[model samples]
Target: MRQEKKSEKQEEKNKECLADLHTTDPRDDKERIKQTKGGLLEDSSNWILKHDDFRRWRNNDEARLL
Candidate 1:
């Protein structure tokens, strides 16, 4: 039940993010660049690369292929 509530909140947040992207002004190139460099896109990718689970999985895969 708690997990479902968290999942619903995340889904709503994602929807709002997508809606905001569509509403952003196209003329604001500087704002777009700032967002691209410093926003969720970069943060999420960085998190994945640095995450412990990903690191362990990557190392295990590399060792397995040897």
Candidate 2:
């Protein structure tokens, strides 16, 4: 029916909108570092200071092991 076709089109449009919402453009590595590592530093300066590459370190797993 015509109503069924219109509903299908609306559903496709809604899916396209949701797909665009889900994709994130790649962010600058430094900015991600600043946000996450800086937050950690702000929270606990002494803990992060022990690591030489604290600014660039991504995973806290190694730090946790230490």
| Model 1 lDDT per residue over 9-56, tens place | 999999999988785565686678778887445465687888898889
Cα lDDT tens digits, model 2, 1-66, are: 999999999999999999988855466655787787773344455767667688446455666665
Which candidate should be chosen as best, given lDDT against the real structure? Answer: 1
Worst 10 residues of 2 by lDDT: 38-47
Task: Point out the worst 10-residue segment of candidate 1 by lDDT.
Answer: 38-47
Residue pair clashes in candidate 2: none
Look at candidate 2 and tell me the lDDT of residue 49. Answer: 60
